[model samples]
Target: MSAAPFGFFGKIIEIDLTGGDARVLPLDTALVADYLGGRGLATRLFYDAVDPQCDPLGPDNVVVIAASPLIGTTAPTSARGHMVFKSPLTGVIGTSNSGGGWGHTFKSAGYDALVIKGKADSPVWIDIAPGKIEVLPAHHLWGQDIHATNDELTSGFEAGSRPRALCIGPGGENLVLYAVVGNDKNRVYGRCGGGAVWGSKNLKAIRVQGKEKIQIHDKERYQSGYDQALYLLRQAPVTKRLMRELGTAGLVELINVINMLPHRNFQDCTHRPEDLERMSGETIAKTILEKAAGCYLCPIGCQRHTRIDGDDGSTQRGEGPEYETVVLMGPDCGIYDLAAITTANYRCNELGIDTISFGGTVACAMELGERGLLGAEKEGGLDLRFGAAAELEKLAVDTAHRRGAGALLAEGSYRLAERCGRADLSMTVKKLELPAYDPRASFTQALGYMTSPSGACHLRGGYAVSLAFFGGTKEIPRFSLLQSPIAIRNMQNTGILQDSLGVCRFTGYAFGSDPWSRMLTGVTGMDFSVFRLEEIENRVASLERLFNVEAGATAADDALPPRFAETPIVVAGEEKMVSEQAQERMRRDYYSVRGWDSEGRPTRALLEDLAIAPRAGRAS
Candidate 1:
């Protein structure tokens, strides 16, 4: 306890904007033992800082930025950072993660996490450098997009030792609920309104730069674990070839082949072969791709660098329209033009908005327009029809700047549906829009979305589509109502472990429990095993559930949207829905496994067994 943990710098900082003060605090070793790092420790800190009574957009809401233990080292794909906050979008306990270079630098600055609170009197940004911390005026940077902000911040800074700025765009400045906090001008903590939270605090950005070597406790053991992880990454076909070579967009046609690709706002789950081909990763690579980009310590390099000719004869370049962004923005909106999707993706990153939410909500408006319910000439002169590339591009900007119908569209899909009196048309759970995968086509995927803390989130819900579409490591039935819950739980645990460790989720594809355990034990000098890691993952999830329950969650919140219950995907003339009976069974099975009541709240005994107790801020 006296010396720093092998993988940590043994420092945590809390900043209060209202008072313009900051403090470094000590984290308990036992607490660190229970909830390793990344999202786990951040979740615990969130509960300690904010309760159900806290207003999400107000100063009372807590913003926790934490790093995983494996960061700042030779660990593969280890540069990850997590943010846990009260979601201004979903009105629940929320979290988002990013990996570029921020975490490693932050750790090098000798801190494990940063908790931000209160609000600045004016626009400001925090500077974190080795042995230095200060809040500086950002009045001029207030209205700029993330790209411009990045350029301005790094303008005169030393290129060799430049600080990495994580900032928001005009979307956040306008309080667009789904605004993103972007890192390195492209990589973002994209979901659950992380940018809006920053905007609320009058915080424009955070810049981190540092120089420190991360010490390895056991060199031989760490090398052995590191080598195993590297070997797995090289050997895994999906990670090395499919993701590294083709990028995530390669899965577009693969999902289409399985009849699980969401098209036209979930009205159809598959597209015509030609359209699917046009929107696939191969098409992007052939047309406008410049290169593949990788995060810190990552081997796969799944990020695609694309550039397409702009309307004025210039070229627009951006990082990625990952599979989720491509499918949600392309097929979901019925726009198969890859260039158009690329432009929309570019606009999203530039403006700091969640492309999934923005595209999905716009697609909902498209369906509403088709039904004559909305989007008329009187409705802000908006063309909410499907497949209008120009309109789509315009709307992306409008949403970020809160222009025209973009103002309404910024409310996100669930609230937009409520305003239009058509929540049934919205493909969402817990008010957050669904990702690219249609749950009706994949039962396990459906369960994950329904029960996810962030509401219909695919990644937070464990991306069960790996087993459902691509053959994953575990062999589980994609459609069996009986067996999918087990796999979903396993996937969720794996996600928790990865998130907690601050490594890329793709690591799960390459290495399983053994590699992860070896990495943690070797780097941190902790006794790690598959069994111990699962326990920690479960404890983390249980604590999150406890946070939500205290935040007024119920079993009803664990259910899907009304559309998923009634409307079924007619794929190849086979009507398929997750079904009321199957969904009920999955919920029951998952609850039984979690030792929770039917309402998804962890029982007292379960918390006791996990050594988790409700904190002082937990709501009565």
Candidate 2:
């Protein structure tokens, strides 16, 4: 009802796909003040609009995409978009972020967020611009891969007004549990099952183009933070040269150096030095890398644009085979062929599957086959051996299509292992497959994974390994029990702020919340001091915990698989594993620091203190 704030349009587009109806709603300024934006704001809106216990793929499931106030600004890496939904894979809160031009363009379309509810009778795509919105029939777009869908939807627009599309490929249409949403051709909301949610609703894509400008209230203050951030980013070795030179896969050797690299479904962290080099960032850069790219306004330029020569002498061009894709699909499965991993990476992107989850699931299947758990008949004659490089790309195609052995792989590692009667073999926390990092080496990282709202996400789970490798002054002891709890808590909160602000996680390597505080205050003309930002981070984290708890999550759910405890990996000449005693103690300490009760539920008093309304029958 009132005018929007300086940094925001204070508008939300609500779409009811069942009826093909859309309405523009005024976003409450007070809510924006409390939640900030992006992940924080989307989470608040989603928690209130949908039932926590609703089936994830059912019509009742809701999807919320919000852009931060900084999105349309000049801040580095300010083009990220945050999406939240109930995860079909993990069956809990599904939160994911992506870096690309889509977020900035969506914000520039004169709205702050988009919310979709109910299910469409057929496939459709939403077209948005200033003062115009329509749900168009997308029957022709339904079965297309991500690149085709993107090109088809974004075509016909004028040069400067070409729309940016966020869409799902065949993986999503088939409802592969870990399907990802692709934007800017390759950038993806890669974690959780957001693409599956889009599929369930019969939504193909949402294309947006606009030229709306954001208002900056204090240019001097904003410039001050901007200058400091750039200076610090230039000074940090990770952001300054390492990312620009080698990209994220550069971490392969470094992570291996710390004994944190996973191998053979996390059987061990051992790898031959040559094998490591074969899949490292240096290999990608030297062998297949066509060029390095960056997202909107990003300086780190971690995006890897590469090409690989096919056996038939055909050269295929695509992006990535980043650290996670390389290790998880390579040595973790006992295959270190860069060409194989890169080819698989391209297939996963085109099909809209999550490389991390797919790799982990394949490794699980390999272990199952090695132990005689996989039925020979059901495998369709595909070898499920640990080093089956031939099956790597084939499995990706099958999984996306839910065909043959991939039907089992499509269910993710947890379900595949459980169906095979060996749930313990699944290396996951909360059913979401763990990232490339082996938690046995870092106690703080292990704690972060345990407490992360959306299952075992390194980004959502604090990215504690970053501190281990590049924290500089902010780094903490990786194995300290006393420091692990609060340390991980702070790291998770920092992640919350970055996601909420729509910034890059790599930016944290350069500076903390102070610079961002100044920029936010300058843009919104509001008091966003470090203390207030911390309060907002705590509130958002507590709110997410509330949603999970109401969805039947418990302290028990915040745990790693049995392998993390029983199987110890040697680190620094000593066997290391997260013991049960250590896990319980750290979990308890984390809850205390987060102001949650012992059972991992937020107390009603604490919720009230943070201004989060308690759901009915919760926070008792």
lDDT of 2: 0.91
**Per-prediction TM-score, please?**
0.97, 0.98
Q: How big is the positional error of residue 398 in model 2, measured in Å on the Cα after superposition?
A: 0.8
Q: What would the per-residue lDDT of candidate 1 be over residues 1-620, giving only the tens digit for each residue?
A: 45666888777889998887988888666656778889998998877887666888898888998886678787887888999998988888778889888888888888888999999999999988767889899999999999999888766876667778899999888889999999887999999898998999999999888877656777788788888888889998977877767889988888887788887888877578998888788887787779987898888899898888877999888877789889888889988888888888899999999999998998988888887777343367555788876777788999998888898888998887777788888888878888988887778899999888888887788787664445556556667788877778878888888888888988887778787788787877877778888899899888888878877878878787767778888754678887677788899999888788877889988988998866854443
Per-residue CA lDDT of candidate 2, range 1-620, in tens? 56766899989999999999999999988777889999999999998789999999999999999998788899999999999999999988999999989999999999999999999999999999999999999999999999999999888888988889999999999999999999879999998989999999999999998999989999999999999999999999989888878999999999999999999999999998888998889888898999998999999999999999988989999999888999899888999899888899999999999999999999998998899887652556534889999889989999999888877888899998897799999989999998999999999989988999999999999887765544577568789889999989988999999999999999998999999999999998988899999989999999999899989999999999989999899998999999999999999999998889999899988988998875424454
Q: For model 2, what is the error of residue 407's alpha carbon versus the real structure, in angstroms, after optimal superposition?
A: 1.1
Local distance difference test scores for all models: 0.84, 0.91
RMSD of candidate 1 to the truth, in angstroms, is 1.9
Positional deviation of residue 16's Cα in model 1 after best superposition, in angstroms: 0.7
* Residue 583's lDDT in candidate 2: 95
